[model samples]
Target: GAGVSQSPSNKVTEKGKDVELRCDPISGHTALYWYRQSLGQGLEFLIYFQGNSAPDKSGLPSDRFSAERTGGSVSTLTIQRTQQEDSAVYLCASSLASSGAQHFGDGTRLSIL
Candidate 1:
């Protein structure tokens, strides 16, 4: 029962650079979601994936943001061209199903310099 785990709990990168954040979901969970919480702002949904279905990318802020889940267990979020405005805590969560209550990870705090 390894819950969910995220890497580089804190990351500082220069603007315009690319950064990849990783997430490991709990075993047997088929729903995974990504969200971003900016300083003093509410959580914004980024993307969601369930089983082998097409990912819901409607919430992705821009083309610069993308994510992929492999084997329905691990996921990675990639920012192609980082910007100061993109600095936020990238949270990953998972649940038994898309509509179930999600368990959240501490998140990878990305800071664009």
Candidate 2:
């Protein structure tokens, strides 16, 4: 796809399980971001990756959440020991540069049981 792509559009899992969400950004985009949107809530930044610089993970809510962008392209967000509160739509976006406009994916909806 020419735009950002996220896998497993919907995920339903037990509360205690772990889940991995994948994001493939637009080719040649040097900046990628991960965000979460809960029901009726605005998007919350989770992580950011710009080129080879260290990823900005300060937005992550807890240690259980982590993400990584590999080879400056595909990125993955992993949630360990999922909880009901973790349920939300995970959105992926990419831009030509950190300050450029970003293109977003449809997002992956996660449901915790």
Each model's lDDT comes to 0.93, 0.94
Tell me each candidate's TM-score: 0.95, 0.96
RMSD of each: 1.2, 1.0
Candidate 1: which stretches are off by over 4 Å?
none
Q: Please provide, for model 1 over 48-96, each residue's C-alpha lDDT reduced to its tens digit, 9 standing for 90 to 100.
A: 9999999999999999999999988899999988999999999999999
> Residue 66 in model 2: shift from native, Å?
0.5
Clashing pairs for predicted structure model 2, backbone only: none
Q: Candidate 1 versus the native: TM-score?
A: 0.95
Give candidate 1's error at residue 71 in angstroms.
Answer: 1.2
| Candidate 2 segments whose C-alpha is farther than 4 A from its true place | none
Candidate 2 per-residue lDDT over residues 1-113, each given as its tens digit? 88889998999999999999999999999999999999776799999999999999989999999998889999999999999999999999999884579999999999999
Q: Tell me the lDDT of model 1 at 51.
A: 95
Worst 10 residues of 2 by lDDT: 93-102
